[model samples]
Target chain A: MTTPTPRANSGPSGTSDAPAVPAVPGPLAALPDADPAARERLHARLVDGAERAGLLDVAYRTLETPVGPLLLAATEEGLVRIAYGVQDHDAVLADLAERVSPRVLRGPARLEQTVRQLDEYFAGRRTRFELPLDLRLSTGFRREVITRLPDIGYGRTESYARMAAAAGSPRAVRAVGTACATNPLPLVLPCHRVVRSDGSAGGYAGGAEAKRTLLTLEAA
Target chain B: MALRPFEEIVTEYGPMVLRVCRAVVGPHDAEDAWSETFLAALRAYPELPEDARIEAWLVTIAHRKAIDVVRADSRRPLAVAEVPEPAVGGSGTGGPGAPAASANGQAQQPPWERDEELWDALKALPRRQRAAVAYHYLAGLPYREIAAVTGVSTDAARRAASDGITSLRRSLPGRTEQRTDAGARQRRAHQREERGERP
Candidate 1:
């Protein structure tokens, strides 16, 4: 295949009286093609610099799951948010920029360890997520409820009343439901393990279907 | 109005900056210049005006980075034997008629590799002319922006680019005809494919 030169009208040679040289291809077309590996390396380097300079406010990556794509985001503090594809990925990112900081980037390398744990968890090989939790998105009673969720364990289910009691307010069962409904980091925190007192799956941020899928995945 | 994520900026202008870097500093030092330019851009991105022309901003940053690499090269004596391979992956030693792929993945003969005369001619131009040509022709910057970046008047920037192109054409006679023919052939093939003629 022959490379197409830039249009003669667009280049510096356009108005020259000299014999029309073939419009030199712009450096973009003329330069050697970029290697995928080299591009990845450059991205990694940029992320490293941004992290060092404290310019990276939020870094996120999307993971394809049996359920759907999951958006996982983190700050320098730790993994901060996880959302299902149904949550409207772009809207989630916008909210993250507002609530956290506007300096966000899609840097997958930053979530390497988190992704590994998630992979193992989805495969049912890991019973727990050992990564640092950033719970800044939840606060007060909601924060208290989610903070107690990890104790619900890998395959076990707990009632909303039981979660409320564990959070030190048994009467706040409805609040516990609200907390579970808004859990910022779902699977990692195991919030889906909370069920209704009647043993029915309660409301879930990832939708009732996703909650059931997680429960089934765990039960198996 | 919020600033776009620096990631988008990188995606949109990364290749353009890479090309500018390669043209200004040669392929060997281009990657370093490209990396440094982006790193610097990221650091200052939050404060950049929303209306700022991002392409010009990136090109300006690349210009500074290329100068840094050149200055450092001059200070540290040339180590011809130890010079690292071109960091972006190609050998930068592809011979005339060597097969190279375009960004779109088509197997095309690289004109730059085939016509070393053009590169030599570019290098022979004055520094201001070389930069003007690269920014205006390669980066597609306006004469005003090129003038601002190169610290020359707009008229001077235009003249530099024009002179640079004239010199290249004079030095590399007959090369244009080959490229134009190749370009015409490619356009025909493209039209054929668009019309569902290519199998």
Candidate 2:
């Protein structure tokens, strides 16, 4: 640790018996006690005010589930991205910053309705989500595939080839598979509903095990 | 590497920036300065370089925000010069010298609630010296980066920090001893860690 170097070169020469100056604490270490809860409340208010004033372009929060932590993010449009823990939450936020906007904050209050609905879904009370979604992260065929997913209905599964045909590209089975693998919004958009043509569950963005968990939950 | 979430950045650096703000502008204006600094940083975070030193970046933003606060203060109507005596009991409302209540009815604690002597010593330093000490000692910025932020030469930055520390030592003799004792305790703890002993 670099002790603050004393003023050895400058200042009037002192006699040898002068008391030594104590080391200054680091800037952060020197602060008076702050109420963390108050600060958090203050930040939430700031973010909300900023968002309302059109200064904040993105807001995000994490939600806990039986599976693990899920990163939920939104744009001015609506809920945009959802990533499982395995997707690396930090990387997902960086992607949102690059793709959506850098003005992102952890304003959980903005996601209150979304989280409440999600909690209801997880608790097996809600059968559908009525939240607004921003699908700008997906484009072209992928967007079409994601758009078609909700139509597969809750508790129903679809084969990739059949889903590809439903997406207006019957021969684009591989493309549909690619779409599911890279869906920016997973559980909320229901990418786990797509399986292999043989009825074996295919890959999922949240990893194969998470996909299994979601499927089993829906089947029950 | 990609930039982490702005939320993570806030969690990691908020306290440090808050401390810097309070030290530079006093507790009265610290919260506003902090909020402005972060709001500005968030607006530009996407374009920040991948490997940029986040602490330095935040300090630079904080320096600019603190200047803005100072400018705004200069434009405000002057308050009476009398300093309030410290309060005797625990009170949320700031004592006589407390900051005016915020718009939301939040009563910010007065400087006396903390180390008044140290805060007074800090506030008495010349602006350059105060900034230098806060950036170097508080924020841990090197003289080179401090120079960049303060627009002073590196040598000047170092001199200002040194001068500031000297002034503080003179003003708060009792507190200086406490800091020294704390430093010694920390050193002992580090030594214990090196020896694989529990601190």
Best TM-score goes to which candidate?
2
Tens digit per residue, CA lDDT, model 2, B1-199? 5577677788777866776787888766676688788878877787899899887899999999999988887797675112332221123222222223332233454333356666677778899988887776666666667888999887788788778777765665434222433333334323333355222
DockQ of 1: 0.18
TM-score of each: 0.75, 0.78
Per-residue CA lDDT of model 1 for B31-119, tens digit only, reads 67888898888878777888988878998999899999878767866663133343442233222221223332322423454445555
Model 1 lDDT per residue over A112-195, tens place:
999999999899899988998788999998988888888878899999887888888889989888888888998988889999
DockQ of each: 0.18, 0.20
* Deviation (Å) of B32 in candidate 2: 1.1
Please tell me how candidate 1 rates in CAPRI terms: incorrect
Q: How many clashes (backbone N, Cα, C below 3 Å) per candidate? A: 0, 1
In model 1 chain A, the worst 10-residue window by lDDT is A6-15
Recovered native contacts in candidate 2, as a fraction? Answer: 0.23
| lDDT, model 1, position B105 | 31
